[model samples]
Target: MSGKKEFGTTADGKQASLYTIRRGTCEADLTDFGASLVAFRTEDRDGRLTDVVLGYDDVRGYEEGDASMGGSVGRNANRIDGASFSLNGKTFCLDRNEGENNLHSGWNRYEKRIWKTEGVSADGTSITFSLYSPDGDQGFPGNLVISVTYSFPEEGALQLLWRAQADQDTVCNPTNHSYFNLNGQGSGTDICGHQVQIFAEQFIPVRKGGIPTGEQAEVEGTPFDFRAPKEIGADIERADEQLQLTGGYDHNYVLAEKQDRMRRAAVVFAPKTGLRMEVITDEPGLQFYTGNFLKKQKGKAGAVYDFRSGFAMETQYFPNAVNLPQFAQPVLRAGGAFESATVYRFSRVLP
Candidate 1:
């Protein structure tokens, strides 16, 4: 498979560019708009290649803002309580959309802007996309230069490497918002059959608006326990107040020392298909969002995506970190480089 297929014209009805990177059976198509992934075709257990990612085939869908898709979330991913923070002894106010909380940089989100793209393959299995965020853009104090690398090697690992330098001090919490379904897109109605195991003994509980309550509790004997492989829907319908507040699983699980860095944070396996995926990241936390907001959208092959049809296990710094000094710090320094890596290794177990 190749990513050379035509995407579409530019947002202004002018010329458009398409970039592709292919290795073996893995191929991904990235268009200029929002630096989005138009197509990500990977092989399934039966050796069938499918576009497992949920996206709109037309460029207009991306311009119209239906889904975040495979775009890189930035400036800061997740929420920041009250849309305000105190840094350098000065108070900074941000655009608040989620009630009093700031969700994904509010009005100045990176998802809403186009990114400058360049196709680089020093080793042939990886392609890097780079963009520069101007100072004072998104109400942040920095002109940040960032790079995101997507690679698929023999290990079937998609390693996301972020390197950045701020012209001024700013917060850099970058993470890819790629939704996954190991059963393959359009193949079914839900990912409930897939089993998941997260390397987290405790998880940060969140309020109704998705902000942490500054309490990290153990997952033992609770539905949040994923130390062993369990169905995502096993405890999904529980009567827990936190679960009901978020509509589903939408909490950040605190990773163990090893799996939190230099190891896999979680592993998911589809017993029916033998497709196993392991997530390895340097980030301290992983957000488990069960697509609670996907309201019956059409996916590949005209298949409708119902709630929990797919899930996004995003690895990054804890949400609302700016407000909770007790949690891991999301702040970046002028001289220090901000780096976070997450790898998803996919392999087919023999029947």
Candidate 2:
């Protein structure tokens, strides 16, 4: 099933609409304001519906609250060291929002803008949002046309698809930043108790300002190891330089090489709810953030969200890939098109 409703008005007086798509009892609420997944409701162990993803009840909270909550981040999803990159021998400078580095393409964020509703599937299981970025927008060179589709393709699964083409060669790495708490958004619980397992054997370590140190360090014998399911709080407070550097798990994990484009990236399970979420993506890296910076802020239905209240599994190309020779570049050639897909498969596991 699918439907649309008025979410609220943007600060700029633009009307923002919310679209809902459902498969069985599981449903996702998406907003045009950022083409974001505002809420995802699925059944728990007791067969009760629960909203797993975190967000506000209105569009204002999304605009004034956490900038990345359930947002579709784009143009370039992660940081660019020195706030600049050279493309085809031409250097392009970007906004330095995070010290001297550019985080999420600086202030001209795609997550804060409203996207055009390309179309909603007749079967009410999919919807697509489109956006146009002119050349020099946010210091990126390209007349880019992008589309993001949110769909419930099957029972217990939500898939996100991204497609884009640029008139000029440019950097294009997009990802969905959705903070998830399987205990329910209003459960007033932290995700520290959730068990997580990432398939990556290596991870990128960062220095100050969260820029990659340009090395893919082994996860073996380190706190970053997650080949087996373990509590998120396990070793999170250990005396480790990497954990202390970002205040938690904020670095990118180098996904193991796979011949298939679509592969399992990570798995997270909430014992309290018996809800298991498996992240599958085609991207080469998975950024596992523990919500280390979340302050005590009011969220949906007056729920107060505090530190470690939620976590994000962002699938994308490696951070600073545009500048690092060792990493795969995110460059999209002129007149060329590319597509990326990620699926969040959910199920109730019996404890």
Candidate 3:
């Protein structure tokens, strides 16, 4: 069954609520504000329930945190070079929030807004949240209607499906920005010891300011290689150029050029808790970030989240795809619709 509770009001006094769906041993907590994932709990190997996704106890923490936490990001997730892009012979300039580029759709990103509850499943297995964006919002040329659904039907899995349609041709790429700590949120430690494996052979290299340099570098000999399971901190501290550029593991790994089919993207193992999370998605790229810049911020249950405490695997189209012709284009036509799905499977590693 599912339950709903009053989350809180937004800065503009818009009312918000949290919907929770439970199936077997898994439970997902989602809020209408930003269509964010508030918490995801799974039974550990010790038979203890643990909330694995990092988040706050209320809506105020999300508004005050630097990281997006568990919110949905869109209007072109990630960065756009120089905060500008050309489409149909017209150059569109976006609001620059990160240096000379646009990061996660700038200051007025979708994560800062409140979404409406669109629908719920008859069996209480899913909840859909939606928002409408006017044409020229965030300097993008389209009136877009977006919906994101969170579904929990099995004991150890949660699926996120995103859909968007526009009245005018525009850039549209959306992904969830949920920081994960399989050991559980507010656990007072980082994911440095978690072993991670990403099924990618090449990655998009970024220069200073976190903009892609247009080169698909091989991960053969660099610290970007995670082809096999390895501790997150093993090569994270290496004196590599890319590692230093982003201050940690913050780069986009290019999946094989597959079309419209869900594929395995990544797997993360938290040794201490014996929790394993497998990511599957139909997107073309995955942005792996090690939360390198996180500081001692307040979180759920009076938890002080410090640097490198959690990590994120954002599955979506490549960053700055609007400016790169060679990359997967994120442009949506007037009559076309965008649809993508990603799933996170949680299971306990038995001793």
Candidate 4:
């Protein structure tokens, strides 16, 4: 019969399913719970393979939790300062889930809600997950319909294609928050042995509350430099001003060297497992968060993920773009369409 339609009742009775895409040697397990990514597996240089990202064992974790990893986030992915914004002539208030800031569109955050899946390919290599957001569901005007496609090509790459359209004027910026560990999930803490290089020449400095300061500071001399390969924890705990302000490396890096279209943003590698991950995106900025807040959380296989267990390089226009006029706007006016791309190409790198 067909190779297990990718969509079926998971081990748990919550309508979860596994999806396999055919671009490379990748298989993405997606669940309707939180529209979450349950597992993303790929191989390395020696043909030894492993699951290289952190995710829940079932649907229950996503439906009632907030770790946010490997799940879709928001009508507004990041944050809106003070939990309010004035657009056109009217001002709207959002759920103050995090202090005075409204994050991930509030209450109706995709990371915490279920979505309906559609169209599973014969061999189980392509699948689509979609959700509809009603007018003012999260205090944002417009009924928004969002869809994301997961596909793997002949060469082994996992691509995320994001699409959204709204009927009324509103703001929308959605992103997947997947915590990746090239050495494989349930491994251990500290990505100390992994080497990374990002194409960013500058970075956004943040405040004590983790909000951007609106200034694009150069990443050359500081610990933020990743233009060349460097260990993630090399200068992480150094007493630098930016590092001190945000408690760790949780800032936005401005990707450079664009060729007028999509470009390479960052590369990550795990020396022990021979696994390497390359991120390519159309967005101008990439947020590098070192998972500085893991706080001994129990993850897959009952493994305790300590601080810096996994990291994320989320490509986007920018955070708090709604508050910063100079930054690329995240506003999608009525009748406007929003499109974005993020690709995580995996391969095993050996010494």
Candidate 5:
């Protein structure tokens, strides 16, 4: 099923619409502003419906909120060291938003822009949103055209397809920054009881500013280890230095498989609701953040979101990838296409 509603109007007087897509037992509300996934509802083991992705009640909350709630992040998804990188022997300095480093494309964030509607699918299973980033926009070289498509299939999967093309060599790494709480959006419960398992044996270690230190450290025996299923809070408060530095699990995990191959990256299950979500991506790294910094923010149904209330499984290239030669390069060349897909497959786990 498919439908549309008037979300709100932008400050520039542009109108935004909230589109809804539905499949077998799933429904998603998407907005043109930021091309954000405003809400996603699925059934649990008892066939009880729950909204898994977090967000507010209306467009204004998204416009004035913390910005990243269920939004598409780009032109580079994660951090870039020192807010600059050398591409083709030229230094491209980006706007720094997180300390001395640039996080999620800084001030000119895609999450704050109004994307154009690119039409829905013939079967109403997908809604495509498009945006254009001019050359030198946010200090990045090249004129870039980006399209993010959110699709809902009949088999209980919410898939995201990201495609981009540039006129010059530029950085293009986009990911859906959707924080999820399987129990329910605005459920007022922390994700500590959620069980998480990442299909990675190693992770890129971070420095003081959340920049990768160019080291793919082993996850064995460390709190970073998630090769096996365990409670998200099991090792979160450990005395481990990495945990101490970031305050929780906020680092990038190196996928066990090689890069650019669509594969399973991680799985999260909320025992309370019997909701299971499996993340499949073609990207090489997964930023598993546990909502460590979320403050008391208002949410739907009069719920206030606090720390650990949600978590994000962001799939993309490593943080500061352009500066670290060892990391997978994030450069999209002239006339070349940058294509990637990530799927959040949902299901129920019965007692």
Candidate 6:
């Protein structure tokens, strides 16, 4: 089933609309503002439908909120060292939203903009939102056209497909920043107890400002290790420099080399709800972030979200990849097209 409704009005007096798509008992709510995932509900082990992702009630909350929440990050996702990068021997400076580094493409975030509904599946199980960014927008080259498609192709899977084309050479790396709380967004419980397993042997370490140090450190014997299923809070509090730098797990894991097919990135299981979420993607990096900086903000249904209340599994290229020659470049050449897909498969873990 699928339908649309008026969410709210944007600051510019533009109307924002919400689109709902459902299969069986699983439902997903998305909005035209920022092409974001507003809400996602699925059946837990108790056979109760539960909203598992965190976000505000309307478009106003998303527009005013600093946290990306369930926003579709774009142009260049993640930080770029020194808030600048050179392409084709030309240096371009960007908005330094995070100290001297740029985070999520700075204040002109894609999440805050209104996107056009390109198409909605006839069966009402999928919707695509598109946006156009002129040249030098956010200090990046190219007149970029991007689209994000949200689809429910199966009973317990939500798939996201990102496609973009640039008229000129530019940096383009997009990802969905949805904070997931499998125990239900309104449960008011932190995700520390969730069992997580990341299929990565190494992770990128960051400096004081959360910019990658241009080196991939082994996760073995370290607090960053999650090669096996373990409670998220197990080593999060250990006396480790990496953990101390970012205040918690906010680094990117080095996924396997580029593959023609989708690869399993990570798995998260909420014991209390017996809900398991498996992340699959073709990207070469997976950013596992615990909501360490979440302030006590009012969320949907009078829920107050605090630190570590939710987590995000962002699939994309390495952070600062444009500046790091050792990492895979995320440059989209002139007139070139880019595409990537990420899927979140949900299931109930039987006791």
Candidate with the greatest lDDT versus the true structure: 6
Per-candidate count of clashing residue pairs (backbone under 3 Å): 0, 0, 0, 12, 0, 0
Tens digit of lDDT per residue, candidate 3, span 87-144?
A: 9999999998999999999888898888889887887889999999999999999899
lDDT tens per residue, model 5, 141-213:
9999999999975567999999999999999999999999999987789999999999998998888888888
- Candidate 3 residue-wise lDDT at 107: 89
Query: Which lDDT tens digits does candidate 4 get at residues 1-351?
Result: 113333434344546664545545667777665666667777766776577778765555555446687888878877778888888888899998778888677776777666887676666666778999898888888899988877665456778888989988888778888888887888874786789999888988877667788888888899999999999889988999889876678787887422136788999988888888899888767888888877776666676777888888777767787788877777887888878778888877566
- In angstroms, give how far residue 113 of model 1 lies from its true place: 2.2
Q: For model 4, what is the error of residue 147's alpha carbon versus the real structure, in angstroms, after optimal superposition? A: 0.6
Q: How accurate is candidate 5 locally (lDDT)?
A: 0.89
Q: Write the residue-wise lDDT of candidate 1 on 1-351 in tens digits.
A: 324445566467844455666777677767666666666676667887766667666566665655566678888888988888777777778888779878878775676566666675754666667788987776777789887777775546667787888866788888877777877767775877789999989999887798889998889977789999999888989998888989888889997422234677899987766778888888888998888888777655577777887888888788888777777787788877887788877777775
Q: In candidate 6, residue 133 scores what lDDT?
A: 97
Q: Residue 322, candidate 1: how far off, in angstroms? A: 1.0
Off by over 4 Å in 4: 1-14, 22-24, 256-260
Local accuracy of candidate 6 as per-residue lDDT tens digits, 1-351 = 589999999788899999998887888999999999999999999999999999999999999998999999988889999999999999999999999999999999999999999988988889999999999999999899999999988988999999999999999999999999999999999999999999999999998999999999999999988999999999999999999999899999999655356989999999999999999999999999999999897899899999999999999888999999889888999888899999999999877
Arrange candidates by lDDT, descending: 6, 2, 3, 5, 4, 1
TM-score of 4: 0.92
TM-score of 2: 0.98
User: What lDDT score goes with residue 289 in model 3?
Assistant: 95
Kindly report the root-mean-square deviation of model 1 from the true structure over all alpha carbons. Answer: 2.3
- Candidate lDDT scores, in order, read 0.76, 0.92, 0.90, 0.76, 0.89, 0.93
Clashing pairs in 2: none
lDDT, residue 262, candidate 6: 92
Q: What is the overall TM-score of model 3 with all chains considered together? A: 0.98
